[model samples]
Target: MDSVLARALIEDPTEDGRLPLFLLFLAFLATFLITRTITRLIRAGKGPFRDRVAGGVHIHHAIPGIVLTIAGAFTSVAVDGSSPGAEIAAVLIGIGASLVLDEFALLLRLQDVYWEREGQLSVQVVSLTIAGLGLMAIGIDPLSDHTLSVGHLVIAINLPFHVAGVLMCVAKGKYSTASVGAFIPPVAWIGAIRLARPHSAWAKRHYSSEKRERAADRAHRFDDRYGRWGLNIEDLVAGKPTASPAVSGQEPSDPKGAA
Candidate 1:
């Protein structure tokens, strides 16, 4: 029973359950094909944010499923007379729960990205908080299951993950593509914090351009208003000012060589 418990801890389902084995193989093939196709699409710049996040979520969750499946299969071989059905049941329950929870967390992270891009502060805060709480709940809930051997491990693993997600939000003020990549873990959060500050280079370039444009516009308007005045000065200097009006009861005098 110690060996059984140890095998159950890993909860790999692929080896023991024939049906799951087939499904696992099928899922692996599908994941491979989909990942390849998505890679090509991404290279072609046809993949959007949703697609990338979705793909990441799928692969991320699938990895654990594959692992558990393999462990399950190995466990079946070890137990000479144990019912594969019971083993598969426990694995499926845990794995299914895990996948749903992981996807939920990813969606929450995606919401942060969305809110960041849209420049919605309230939404960002709310989404990140909710996602964080949801992840915490998932981690805690799994550990409450007495039958699962690795429930404690799952809870332990998620502590760092949750911290990383929170740090990512703190680091990346706005969620750009690069910012999204900074959601990996502690390292990602570190990168994000480093990148989160404003882009001085971009700001400087934009400010300089705006200043130049404003200066040019001001000069243009000044020239438009003062050009006639300047011409009048030139005329006065050249002895060709506009003719003055005649005084009352007096005829106007025309200077020599003046029209």
Candidate 2:
């Protein structure tokens, strides 16, 4: 296995330094899965591990994640080439990223809200990260590679087309689509031409009352159609969200209160 890996890293002419990136993805996935398992077990009160507290203050895993991320980033910058050192640095960075992203809700909300609905943000972010990395692993290079074969003049002429597509997708509030479309132009075109989501700024600015109603209806139908699938995926990845206790007959208030 080591020999095969070494050959792929060193002898493959088509690698283009992607081996380290592939390793990074593997490391990130492993680290994230392990971290999620441990956290879920802790939440269920079934793990040998317990939350770490020092001097009456709980220590969140994000602290170590931040340290590892900084260390790995600096190490990668200082390392000069696509050697084993670079691979190790990539692994460190991946692990750190997984740890940090696992607690993304804490960072975003500035509080501990793991196991709550808001915690689903972490799962979403991780899922997107995994998809992006997987795409890269499969040789999808975003915008930068699109003009590789074209002459400079042709690239210059085509640049506006790509830029317009990207902008249109963004304006429609399809950020994930825009990101993928930046790499693959057809995706961007589709996103650009699609109706804006009801709450998107584009809808607010350009949609007439009737158009807004239509957009709203589309958004509602979409949510109704796919929301359950999304929830299932989130639960599979990050464990099921724990609901807060209701007060009287009303749904529980937001744990963090209204901002």
> Per-residue CA lDDT of candidate 2, range 119-197, in tens?
6556556655776575455444444555343343453455577667766755565544554565666776777787776
lDDT of each: 0.38, 0.67
- For model 2, the stretches where C-alpha displacement exceeds 4 angstroms are 1-15, 143-230, 245-259
| Model 2, TM vs. native | 0.62
What TM-scores do the predictions have? 0.26, 0.62
Q: Which candidate leads the pack in lDDT?
A: 2
lDDT of 1 by residue, 175-244 (tens): 2212232233444444434423232222233346665455345434544765355334423222232244
Model 1's lDDT to the true fold? 0.38
Clashes of 1: 9
